[model samples]
Target: MNETLPMTGKMNIAANDDWWRGAVIYQIYPRSFRDTNGDGIGDLRGIVKGLDYIADLGVDGIWISPFFTSPMKDFGYDVADYCGIDPSFGTFEDFDAIIAKAHDLGLKVIIDQVYSHTSDEHAWFHESRQDRTNPKADWYVWADPKPDGSPPSNWQSVFGGSAWQWDGPRRQYYLHNFLASQPDLNVHNREVQDALLDVARFWLDRGVDGFRLDALNFSMHDPQLRDNPPSGVPMERVTRPFDMQDKVYNQSHADIPAFLERIRATIDGYSGRFTVAEVGGPDPLAEMKAFTEDGKRLDSAYNFDFLYAPELTANRVRSSLSNWDGTPGEGWPSWAFSNHDAPRAITRWAQDGDVDRMARLSMLLLLSLRGNPIIYQGEELGLPQGHVAFEDLQDPEAIANWPHTLGRDGARTPMPWEANAPQAGFSNANRTWLKLDEAHKERAIDRQRSDPGSMVSYTRELLALRNSLPALVDGASRLLDTPEEIVAFVRTSDQGDVLCAFNLGEQAIDWAPPEEFASARMVADQDTVNGGNAIRDRIEARSGYWAK
Candidate 1:
C-alpha cells in the first residue's frame, strides 16, 4: 500500500451537470431545527428564520426532513398528504416563504419524500381500505388471509409485530413495514407509481431544489408476499423482532429500480434538480449502487454504513470508500455519521472526555472524503446524545425496546441556539415538543460562533478549506498504510494531491511522515504532529491533518 501509486481512476463528478456531487449538505430535522411559534412545534417559518445561519456555514445545500401532513404517530414520517403541508408545520404559504428564503441565500432546499408508505389517515389509504372496490382500492398493499386466518406471510414490521394489519372494512390484511398506521404503498400498481411521481412533480413545480427520498428501497415489495428467510445469526441484543429475518420479501424489491427510473425521468424534466435515496437494511451498499447506478437514476444515495456503525476505524473508512470507487457510470455516494434516526456521533464513537476533540476530527474526516457529506444539525456544536428519561421518551422504538436500543429521540432533541434563553432559543414557548438537550447549552451556536477555537468555528474553516481545494472536493481517494491508531488516505486530482491522516486512538503517539509527505505543506488540519518521531512529531489524541 506504500507503493506511491496513482489511486483509483479519477472521475470528475462536476464535469457532469450534477451539482450535488461532492457537496456538503446540512440535514435539518424540521421539528428539532427551530420553532418560531409558541405552539411548541417547529414550522416552515422557523426554517426560514435559520436560512442565513445555514448559508454562513458554507455548505452547498440543506436537506430538510419530513414536514408534511401527518398524525405525528411516527412524527412526520407518517405522511397524511403528499402535496399539503401539515398545519403544525405551517401552511403552503409558509412553505413558499421557506423556498424563497433558501434560494435567496443560495442554498438548495431538499425536502423529504416519504414514498414508501402513507399514514392511515391519508385520503388514498382511507378510500382504499373501504370495502376494497373503491376508486383507490388497490392503492395500498392489501392481501388475503390464509386458511388459518393468519397474515399472508411471515413478514414483520420494522417497529415490531407482524407486517400485516387487518382492515375491518376490506376484511383483508394490509402490509406495513413500520407502525400499523403507516400502510406500505403498492408501488406494483401503475396508478400508485404515477401518483407518487406526480407528488414529485408537485414539489418540483413549487420551486424546491431537490428531494431526499426516505426509505426509497422500501417503496416496493414482492407481490407474491413471500416469507423472508431467517438469517440464522445469533442475536446478541434483540432490539426489535424485525432483526430476526433477512428482510428479503418485505423490502429491497426487484421492481423498485424501474420505478426509480420513472422518478428520475420526472426529475430530469426540471433543470438543476437533485434527488438522493436513503437506503438501509442488512446490506444497503448493493441497493444504494443500484438506485444511483446510472445517470438515469437518482443523483446519489446514502446508506447507514457510518450512521449505524458501532465503531469508527481506518479499515472501515477505507472499505466503505472503496465500494464507491468513483468509476465511470458509477453512482455517487453520500456519507452521514449522525442524523435524526441514530444517536449522536460523539456519544456513539468518542470516549467520554474526548467529545470536543473527536468532533473536530470527525468534521475534517467527513469533509475530506470522496463524496457528499451530510452534517446533522447541531453536529457543529459537538452535541452529545441527550439523556431522555423513560417517562419523557416520545420515540416508539425507545419505548418498546427500552434499554436495548439507543432510540432516535436523543438525536432529535431540540437544537440549542442560545445558552441562557428559554428552550435554548428554539422557541419563545414555555415548553417545546421535545426537551432541549441541556448539556448542549454550553456548546450552543451563540457561544461557539464567537470562540475561534470552538467546534462550530472549526467547522466553518474546514468547510472553507474543502471548498477551496479540488482534491478535497471531487478527487479520487486511495488509502495509505498506517499504524492501527491512524486512518490515512490520499486524494488526487489535476489540482493537486493531498494526504489526509487521522489519529483515532486516545494517546499522543509518535509517527514518522513518509518521505513524500515530510515537507508537504499544511493545507487544512486539526491536532496533528509537528515534525518526525521526535517529541514534537507525536500526534495528539483524537486529531487529524490534511497536507498537500
Candidate 2:
C-alpha cells in the first residue's frame, strides 16, 4: 500500500462530539494486521506504521481489536489486564506512538474493551477464585453447585458444554460464557462496575478516542441462576449445546442497560468520546435498541444481522435495514458485513458469482446505508476467508466443533500486503500464528493499489463519495418498492437526496425507478447504471448505482 497520505478529502476530526454518528470505522485485528518485529504477530508499532494506509482509505476512524495483556486464550478477547498492554503487542510507549501517529493522520482511534469476561489469569479473577474471601471475591460470577454436584443451571458456554467451571480453590462453580479460562465478570456488582469504569478512564486518559465494547450484552447475567429455555426454533445441525438454548438467563440481563448508562456517563466526561456495543443473542434488535436507546447508554450498537447471514438477497437486506427505522428515541445503528469473528462477506454472499463485481457492489451498498459502516481490515481488498486446516487451527471454538464449522481462524488470518513478499509482507518470520490465505495473495494491497479497477480503489472512491454526500451520512432512509432481486432505498437530507439501488441477483433484469428519480443523474455505478449517465431501465446482474 502507499505510504504517502492523501492531501485532499480527509476526514475532519474537529471537536465534533457526533463525529461517529455516520462515520466509517476500519477494524484492525492487531495480531493479523502487520508484524514489525519479525515475531509473526502484529503489534502497536505495526498499526502506527499502517495509519497512513488506513487514513488514505477515507475512513474517519479505526477500531483496533484488543491488544491488552492476555494469555492468547481468545486472542486478546480474554483480557488479563485491562490497563496493561501485552508484551507481544509492545509497551505503553508503543501504544502512545500509535495514538500520536493515527491522530496526526486525522484518524480517530477506537479500541476494543472486553468488559464481558476476562482471562482466568487476570488479577481480579485470580483473587475472586481464591477462596472467595479476597477483596475482589465477588468480582466474577460464582455459584454453589446443586446438591447432586451438578452445575448451578443449564446455561451453556458459547464454546461448548456447561457455562460453569468447577473452581477447586473457591469450591464453587464460576461462570464462563466462553472458554473455561475466560470467566464472566459480575457486572451486577456495583464495585465491579466502578472498577470497569475506572479502566475506561485509564484508556481515555491515554488520549484514545473511543471504545468498541466487546460482547456488551454478555456483560451481565441473571443472579437467580435460572435455566435458559430452549430456542423453540429448530436447527438442522447443533454443533454445541449453546446453539440449542435461547441464551436468556445466561446473558442479556435487564440490568445491562443500567451499567451502560454508567458507562455512557463516564465516557461523556471526555469530549468527543464514542461508544458502540456488540450485541448478539436470541433477540438482538431489542437488546441493541435498549442498550443505545435515547443515546443515554451508548452512541451506537451493531448486531450480527449481516455478519452471519448465509446469503445477501434483496429481501434479506431490506428486512434487516427496515428494523432500524429512524423512529423517535430509537438508538443509532452501526452495520458490518464482515469482521474478525465472521467469515468474509464476499465469501458468504458472493455465492460463486463474479467476486470482484460483487465486492464493489457490497462496498457501494455498505457506504450508502444510513448507519455507520465498519470495514474489516482486509474487506477493502476483497480478501476471502483464509484456509485453515484442522491441524493449523488456533481458535478453540472452531477446534471444539471441528467439521461442523469453519471457525473464526479463517477470518483472523494475516492481512496480505504484498503479492510476492515473504509471508505476503505481513512479517519477516518463517511462519505466522495463522497461515496467509494463498488466494488472498492475488488481491494483496500492492496489486490493488496500482489497479484503478481494484477493490481498494473502488472502496476509496466509494468512501470519498460517501464523505461528500451528506445524504449518505446521517440522513433519513426509506426503502423503496422494487423488484424482488433489486434492493432500493433513498436517503434524504437537507443537503440533497441520494437514490441507491442494487441488483443482487445473478441475472440482469429490466426495472424502472420511481418517477421522482426519472431524471436523477448517476453519481456512482458498478456496471448497473452507467457512470455520469441518466438512470436506465435495465439493471445488470450483481451491480449497483448511487444517484442524486
Candidate 3:
C-alpha cells in the first residue's frame, strides 16, 4: 500500500442535492480492487491509495461493495455486523480514511447496504433462533413447519435449495431467500425496521455520501408464507429451481415501498445524501419504480435488464430505455452493462469479435443514455471475464450450480494494474484470493496510462464529454425511427438537443440522420462520422455517434 497518499479533511463540491441525476458512478469491488497487506485480499487502505486513479476517471462517485463483518459465505454479501468493518478488510479508521481521501479527490463515496438478510453467525440471528419468546425471536422470518416436516412454503433458494432452513432449537423453519446461512430478516416487523434504520444512521453520521441498497426487493416477503407460482414457461435446462418459480411470495411484497419511505425519510435528514436500490426478479420494472418513486423512496433504482442480458441489440436498448420515459412522478433509473455479479459486457456481447471496438461503442452508448451510468472496476480498461476453474470457485451460487452457469467468480477477479508486476500488481503475495487472468496483463493500467487509443483513455474522454453536455446529463430523450440494426435517440434540454446514434450490426450501411440533425456538428464518434458532421452518407459497423 502507498502510505504517502494524503487523507485530507472533507471538502464539499459546489453541487445541488440533485447532483446524482445523470451522474457517472464507478463501482469498486474492494476485495478485487487492490491488495495492500500481504493477505492477498484488497482492503480499505487499498481503496484509499487508488482514490487518485478513480478521480482521474472523471466519475462523480464510487460505489464500494460490502466490506462489513461477514463469514465469507457469500463473499461479504452475508453481513454479520452491519456497523463494524471486517478485520480482513480493515478497521473503522481505515474506512474513515477512505471517506476522507475520496472526498478530498472530489469523489463521492457510496457503500453497499445489505439489509434483506444477515449471516447466520450474526448475533441477531443467533439469538433469534434460540427460542420463540426471546427479545429478538421475531427479528427474522420464521414459521412452523407442516405436520409432515416440510418447509413452510414451496419457495426455492437462489443458491439452489429450499429457501427455508430448519432450526432445531426453535423447532421451526426460517426463511432465507439466498444461501441458508443468510437468513432473511422479517422487515415487516417495526422493531426490525427500526434496527435497520439505526444501522443506516450509523453510516450516515460517519460522513458517507450514500448507499446502494442490495437486494432491496427481498427485504420484505409475504407474511402468510404462501407458495410461489410457476413461471408459466418451460424449465428446460434450469440450473436452479428458483428460476422455475415466479418469486411472487418470496420477494417484492407490496409493503416494501412504505419501508422504503422510512429509509428515504432517514436519509432525507442528511442533506445531499443519495440512495439507489438493487432490484431483481421476474418483473423488476414495477418494483424498481416503486422503490424509487418520486420523493418518498430511493433516489434511483437499477435493474438487471442489461447486466444479465444474453446479448445487446438495438431493439433491446430501445425497449429498455423506453420504459423510463421521464414521465411526471416516475422514478429515475440507473444503467450498468457490467457489475461484480454479471460477466463483463465485452465478453458477453463481443464473443469471437473485435472486443476493443465493442468496448468503446458500449462506453459511448452507456454515457449517451438519459439515466445515470455505472462503470464497474476494470471496465474502463475493457477487462474481459476471467476463467476460474471448478476447484478455485468461491461463489456459493456458482458452486451450487457448477458446470451449468459461468458463476460470478470470473467477473470478480482482481483488478490488473501492471503488465509485468507480480500478480499483475494487484498484490505482492505469493497467491491471491482469485487467480489473475493472463489476458488481463496486456490491458493493465500501466500499459494504457499513456496510450491515447486505449479503452481507459477513451472512457475518460467520453466521461469528460458527457459531463460537458447538459443535453447528455439531465435532458429529456426521445427515440428516433431507424432501421432494425440502428438505434437513434435525441436528448433535448434548455441548452440544446444532442443526437445519439449507434450501429449494432456488423455491416456498414448507408444511413441518414433525421432532418433536424442532418447538419448538426459531431462532438464524439468511433470513426463513424465524417469531417465534423454527424454522419456522411454511411455509418460503419460497431460504431456510435454523439452530436450537438
Clashes of each: 0, 0, 0
Candidate with the greatest TM-score versus the true structure: 2
Off by over 4 Å in 2: 1-15, 527-530
Model 2 misses residue 491 by how many Å? Answer: 0.7
> Over the full model, what C-alpha lDDT does candidate 3 score relative to the true structure?
0.87
Q: Alpha carbon lDDT of residue 61, candidate 2?
A: 92
Candidate 2 lDDT tens digits, 1-548: 33343423344433477888888999999999999999999988899888888888889999999999999999999999999999999999999998898887778899999999999999998788887678999999999999999999999999999999999999999999999999999999999989999999999999999999999888889889999999765677677889899888889889989899999999989999889899887569899989989989998999998898888899888988899889999988999999999888887887875667767778888888888899999989988778999999999988998888868999999999999999999999999999888888988898998887888887877777777778887889999988899999999989889999888888998988889988899989873323678888899888889988
Tell me, by lDDT, which candidate is best. 2
lDDT of 1 at 481: 76
lDDT of 3 by residue, 496-547 (tens): 8999988887788788898887778888886332236635657777788898
Q: Show pairs that collide, candidate 3.
A: none
- Candidate 1 lDDT over 203-255, as tens digits, reads 99999888999998888888888899987667885666798899888899888
Which model is ahead, 1 or 3, in terms of lDDT? 3
- Judged by lDDT relative to the true structure, which candidate is superior, 1 or 2? 2
Shift of residue 481 alpha carbon in model 2, Å: 1.5
Report model 2's TM-score to 2 decimal places: 0.97
Looking at model 3, residue 443 earns an lDDT score of 95
Question: What are the Cα lDDT values of the candidates?
Answer: 0.83, 0.88, 0.87
